[model samples]
Target: MPTVKPRLSKQHQRWVMPTLVALVSGILMGLTVAPVEAWFLAWIALAPLWVLVLFPTQRLKLLIPLVWGIGYHGVALAWITGVHPMMWMGVPWLASIAIALFCWIAITLWGAVLVTTWAVCMTVFSRGVGTFTRVLIGVALWCGLESLWSLGPLYWSSLSYTQSPHNLVILHLGQISGSLAVTGAIVAVNGLLAEAWIRYQGSGIGNRGLGKSYKAAMRLFASSCLLFVALHLVGFGLYSRPLVQPPQAALKVGIIQGNIPNTIKLYPEGLRRAIAGYTEGYITLADRGVDAVLTPEGALPFMWSEALRTPLYSAVQQKGVTAWIGAFGEQGQSYTNSMFTLTGDGEFSRYDKVKLVPIGEYIPFEQILGGLIHRLSPLEAKQVPGSPDQVFDTPFGRAIAAICYSSAFPEQLRYQANQGGQFILSAANNAHYNPSMPAQHHAQDTMRAIESDRWAVRATNTGYSGIVDPHGKTLWISGLNTYELHAETIYRRTTQTLYVRWGDWLTPLLLGLAVVFKLTSIQASQK
Candidate 1:
């Protein structure tokens, strides 16, 4: 008797294969970011999911993108577990494990929901649309969703970040079109590949249309190749434009990292050590002939009044170099994470942090849910958010400063740039997070530098501090968990990039167009 082969049922074909493909696709997409950083993979990462949506199946298309979002976010955001883990927050061990898992899963699911919603919307809108139209819809929907998320409080990662600050050549695309342009280009390529794939497979299987399918596949493939080449060429043109910084007027800035361990960062004894550590670090840099010394966030580890009363203020006053210090500033019942600038003649200016990290710095809707969250976690002492429009007037130049979490929002920085921010200044306390967090955070700042066309001086406590030029190249970067000072002369440019001028106006416009197209497609289908 001949061996008999069992055929796959409709349910297995529709559900099992699509689900597995979506899962694998999401994982690969996630790998294109930090901890793995296989950026080239981003070109093809969405192909599997894109292909899945092309064919007919009883399987819910919504579930395909949902699984992808879960995979990508689950891996990309794994470091969330390390951010003030439940045990560190004084919860019981078993409960701590459960809490950490819950937090991670919650964040992953939230991101997944946003992504899956986009997929569903795209599927509905893309009915009867050609491959090219589908690609445009995908790009528009993705950009629109990112813009929507950015308008909210929890803006973290974007698809363009997958390319990273390392890919200097292509990253210049950000200067012209911002991160959305890079993301759109990547999606378009994925769509092209998916279209080519469907057609090619149909030809191979000879499903009653071999000749036509092969020709269509060849055209799509050729178009994808042409687009790939054209994008790189455009990138090269943008990259070739020199960002001319005034070499003669370059500010010699010094940065310090105190290497404070997270275990003792906020304790009484640790606060004393932090003051001493940063004082010494500041003196060390001032002695090295720096024109200005920049310190990390919470370097003083005390209230503004106490910081002024300390010997460190006298040291800075005597050193005669401009000093920008990050410390806690208090006003009555409110506390702000502020950056204070002390000139040689004792003139002072302060820029408070506007964007507070939810649940970490300040709990949202604390009036209603504060009591409940307090019982669940020991989070107390909320840091009040500062004015979004404050700019620091430094002796070196008029600068804009983003403290820690504020760096994640590009529009805030763009607004500052529009307000005559010569060069960007960022100070951070990354002492409590994992190494991966800082790397990813640092990458976000790099995009800001490129987007605004300004030199960025980033000072962080306990790692990944560096000077990024207007071109988004890391001129100098410090190692993680190390105490050190980097002294370099950074060029301050006044020129603004396209992103700074128009901001993200293009994305919202595209989003509106997407809605119109979707509604029109539905109407046409009915007709």
Candidate 2:
């Protein structure tokens, strides 16, 4: 019989095919998941990417992670283009796409490196261990990523957040190790499946060992899932019990999503509508018996200052509630992105956003690039940054307020709880982020809730306006492509988790270890 031609053969097959497979699998993974059903398929989706990473070839190994990362981030985050122009209008449409794509590339490269690192480390450790221990250690290795370095900016797009809609039980476990706990399980499952496949395709000489390993891994995975489900059942029991206590002391909160188009946020006409939409939404929430209503970041078209407090304070007082609104606080030629709180009696406090978006909020290399870069690019020269480490006091309790991007960084949330913040409040404008981003963004709140053991209220303009519990479970979420209101219960959690007390100290230590290991390995190879 004639020799059969291999579908993927030689060097081209080794690198190109694996990368293509990884990318395709990544797309499938994204498609398989949604805001609510993220947890179930989290492991399955990553299996292909993990499989590519497991391949032993040097070139295929390098390209596999990079390509997989491209597909993973590119497909998952393509939704940012909708709102980029609002932040910076000078950049042409194509330039905005380029920037978004470029950012995705950076994210992808980082993800690939992380994934490759994980794969390499797992293989190195799995040499002679039983399958279950291997999986357990692998999971630890994966979860250990969250504790390694300031890693949130690189890999916080968690599988649990994607699964929040369908599996409330699964999401609740985040109370233990934060969301990264479940994320680690998901990655380990993917690792288990991918490694099993390789064993199946390999020679029979390793059959007994392979069978034992696969069997052990499956057992561990099954137990893990069952345990996760059991934990959810326990959370449900707690949730079903009397949660809205002191019913008479309820505070009405109105969260506004102005739905203002980004292109016009800075324009005079656009600013008028922006104010109208926010004020109108504020009116609606106020009339609904809200003791305090919140508008999304930069809700007002104009600058936020002690001067604008005149009308805003009067209106808030008239409404018989507090107004927590996002706007620009101007001083001289400088501007600050801020969230201002106005009480029913004209009392005021403001939390300016501290974790500013590096390029989006201000130019990083202005001295080197000169002002010409501003005209060439969409970014503004400087948007005043706020010292938002403090908590804002209200009639209820001390609430930690984190503006849009600030919420993504866990340290800010940890600091809030450490400083006696009884509750966490996040105001965002999803007009720039995709539905996926909101899903991921909202999920991060659960981790913060778990760490601090506090209730989180997330209100956004565009989509995913909702509330989360101390365990990282969502109470309610607003619908997309339309205006909606959600009345979710929230309470203060006096207790805190281990992560909260230590903050990100563990993350840096782990990252340092990984770097040292990589360096040592390089030295050994040279010898």
Q: Which structure among the candidates has the greatest TM-score? A: 1
lDDT of 2 by residue, 1-527 (tens): 13444633565576666767877876655553443333455657777765565455544655665566566556555554444553356767666666666566655566556656766676675444544455555666665654552344344444445555455555444544555655654665566676666554443555646566555545555655665456557556634534443565345566776666566656777676766666666677777776778777777745665436545556677776777877777645777777777776654777878776644666566686445335432224357677645677767777888788776566777777777787888888766666777776675665566556777888787777887766556777787646666555466655665556665443344345545555555566678
- TM-score, each model? 0.92, 0.79
lDDT: which candidate is best?
1
Q: What is the C-alpha lDDT of each candidate?
A: 0.80, 0.62
The whole-model C-alpha lDDT of candidate 1 against the native structure comes to 0.80
What is the per-residue lDDT of model 1 for residues 371-405, given as tens digits with 9 covering 90 to 100? 53453422245578887777778776789798988
lDDT of 1 at 264: 69
- The candidate 2 region of ten consecutive residues with least summed lDDT is 372-381
What value does the lDDT take at residue 43 in candidate 2?
53
Task: Output the lDDT of residue 391, model 1.
Answer: 73
